[model samples]
Target: MSYRNTGTLFTVLVFLFATAGARAWAGSQSKLVAFTVDSVLAADTNKGIDVRIASMGARLRKVFSYTTYRLISRQRRRTQCGRMTGFDLPGGRILHVEPRTVVGDTIGMELVLFQGPRPVMTTELRLKRHAVLMIGGPHYEQGMLIIAITVDTPGSHDVLVHEPRIHQHQRLHAVSTPGQAP
Candidate 1:
């Protein structure tokens, strides 16, 4: 082959190899995610917690007196691995969450709840896309406190709740999942 033709062939081979390497590297990188934090309260009732949450409508009414109890608050946050965010909730409670690891469609997170800088509760959660994690009361009267965390992803409907009444509450809603539309 002529020297010029040989050189052209070498250049084309190098370009193809470089492009393949770049695509491999890009495929290995973790995907970024965004999540939202919501805090809500309901009047403490004699009905079982399952019954109460099942009946909870799309719009929650403020039955408990905020003035008498702790203030209710909501905040939106966006974060990636190694980053942390905080949300303030009713009854002087603050929630701190950090994403520890993200693999494929699963996210590993650390969640901590604090009452005035004192850590009241801490837990780890692995959430899938479009999933929600709800944490309920530490109970005031018949009133219950709910803290919900949801990820922004399409068709990812997984709901996990960690609280004292979760088992009993799970039994009530057989047809609908916690995060799914009721």
Candidate 2:
């Protein structure tokens, strides 16, 4: 074969391989699940307490197609115990969560708050399927810092969100903290 023809054939072969490899890599990626994180501020009062939800509404409306608010009703609080799942947060903070065990409608999980990379505070939480799990701070401004996590699993609408509760009946497994000793 001529040199010019040989070069053209080689280029086409390389392009075919590259397309096949790209498809394989895309197929291997794990499907991502959607979840919501809300930060709220609460203050203690003589009557009881005053609660204020942070402005996640505007942001949610922009990012998500469907948005709704659901109040957290039943929650089981716990101290530091069990395995941990590390979640990277803003301002160089990390949130570690460990789901221990579940009983009936309640699911137990441990949370370890970290600044930079060090563990600052550790606590346990028991949450339901559609409950908001609140984590407050030692103190931020006049009110306490509260981080509310709502697990919004996709239902009939699958185009916008992916369901996180695919295997609800599966046993809870411990996830190792990223960039830390196991």
Candidate 3:
């Protein structure tokens, strides 16, 4: 090959290598996840609301019609895409959350709510960046339980709480497997 052609080939190879590295970095970037588990109690009267979950009280009333909702626990974790992170929930249940990918401003995640060794609920979902996925009802206390999971971009403010943004999520990309993506 001519020297000129060799130089061109080297330049093209360099560009391709850089592009592949960038894509890998983007896929493996750390995701900041915020999860809140609330213990909700219902009553016959429209009397009480917990100040901690006051933001969610109205929504709870609208969806659940329960008299009260309290924030039992609020925790946040940072994990890479496809890595599993476990959260300790009320009633000794374990929640395993795995963040998969980001498409535009939306995030893809998988959740498994386990009681002891058996898996109770497992779902794969995607939601907008600012939205929170609330999984409610599983018998926690007198009433039930609500688990809210949020994954947002770094440097963003705390996500707001709304009436359980549990819309049908479309899978943007095929997952490798649980705990198996880079």
Residue 161 shift from truth in candidate 2, angstroms: 16
Better of 2 and 3 by TM-score: 3
Name the lDDT value of residue 22 in candidate 1. Answer: 86
Candidate 2 lDDT score relative to the true structure: 0.46
Per-model RMSD to reference: 9.8, 14.8, 8.7
Give lDDT tens digits, candidate 1, residues 77-182.
7765666778877777888888776666778889999987899899988886545676765553335576767654323454433222222222234353332112
Which candidate should be chosen as best, given lDDT against the real structure? 3
Candidate 1 CA-lDDT value: 0.59
Off by over 4 Å in 3: 1-11, 14-24, 36-47, 157-182
Alpha-carbon shift of residue 97 in model 1 (angstroms): 0.5
Clashes of 2: 2
Model 2 spans with C-alpha error above 4 angstroms: 1-35, 39-83, 138-145, 151-182
In terms of TM-score, the best-performing candidate is 3
Model 3 root mean square deviation, Cα atoms:
8.7
Residue 93 miss distance in model 1 (angstroms): 1.2
Q: In candidate 2, where is summed lDDT lowest over 10 consecutive residues?
A: 70-79
Residues 96-168 of candidate 3: C-alpha lDDT, one tens digit per residue: 8887876666778888999887899999988787665677656655555777666675655544435455444
TM-score of 2: 0.37
lDDT agreement with native, every candidate: 0.59, 0.46, 0.67
